[model samples]
Target: MARNKREEILDVALEMFAAHGYRGTSLDTIAHRVGLTRQGVLHYFPRKENLLTAILQCREEVNREHLQAGHAHEDLPGQMAAIVAHDHQLSGLTRVYGVLLGESITHGHPAQEYFRKHYATVRERMSASFAERWGDRLPSGLTPQAAATALLALLDGMQQQWLLDHTQTDQPEIIRDVLTVLLGSPPVK
Candidate 1:
């Protein structure tokens, strides 16, 4: 019961956060939606920032699960396309991620440090993966680090665009196409 309640609160909180952003959502609102009092919510998460941390961790775990489920052995472009396809199915989580990511840029935001560290780690790992697959530079003639940076930027930009207008384009297909241009070859199936 306790675990279920906690997960219930997280689900409600994530939806609210996705709709209203972290700064716009409040603990009281989340508690009310979860059929808990403010104190009840506090019992599970002592601070609002703690709730944010948990949500972010949950999102990362979801992404990790998708990657581990046969996506890990693929080439970089294939892995990224798989991730985008997975995200397309989880619109709520994607919205929350986009909201939190945009808000994390504000001064002293709780998620700022987390985003910084996350990007650094992802970029480094992505660069290493690129190097492993294509030596020092990609077939597009960009260094592994530069290609990694471009790939991340493209993925983020595509997500933001898709969030604003879901009818705009097919995200996974576009990603695969652009990645082909960047990689100088089509992504392996």
Candidate 2:
């Protein structure tokens, strides 16, 4: 019962955070929507930042599970497209991630350090992967570090666009096409 209530609170918080951002959403709002008093919510979360931390941890675990499912091709391009497809499928989580990521850019945001470390880790891993796969440069005349940065930017930008008007964008296809061009190879599929 305790775990269930905590999960329920997390779900409501996730949706509200995605819709209103961390700064805009309040614990009172989350408590109200979750059918709990603020003190009740505090019983589970203790602090609002604690709640945000839990949500971010849950989000990371979910993404890690999807990425490790082993359905996508083992290659980098295939993995990249698979990631975008996965995000499209999990639109709610994606929205929360996008909203929190944008919010993290402001001064002294709670998630600022989280996103900073996240980007650094991802960029380091991606740059290493590119280097191992293609030496110093990808076929697009960009160095591995540059490619990694550009790839991250492209993924984030495409996600924002999809969130704005998903009907107009075929995100996976676009990612695959752009990746093919960037990697100087035929499309993954």
Best by lDDT: 1
Error of 2 at 172 (Å): 0.2
User: In model 2, what lDDT does residue 5 have?
Assistant: 95
Candidate 1: lDDT of 103? 98
Candidate lDDT values, in order: 0.89, 0.86
Question: What's the true lDDT of residue 49 in model 2?
Answer: 91
Q: Which residue ranges in model 2 land beyond 4 Å of their true spot?
A: 185-189
Worst 10 residues of 2 by lDDT: 71-80
Let me know the TM-score candidate 2 reaches against the reference structure.
0.91
How does model 1 score by TM-score? Answer: 0.93
lDDT of 1 by residue, 1-189 (tens): 999999999999899989999999989999999999999999999999988999899879998999998788887678788999888889999999999999999989999999999999999998998899889877889999998889989988999998998886577877877888898866475
Q: Who wins the TM-score comparison?
A: 1
Those runs of model 1 whose alpha carbons end farther than 4 Å from true positions after fitting are 186-189
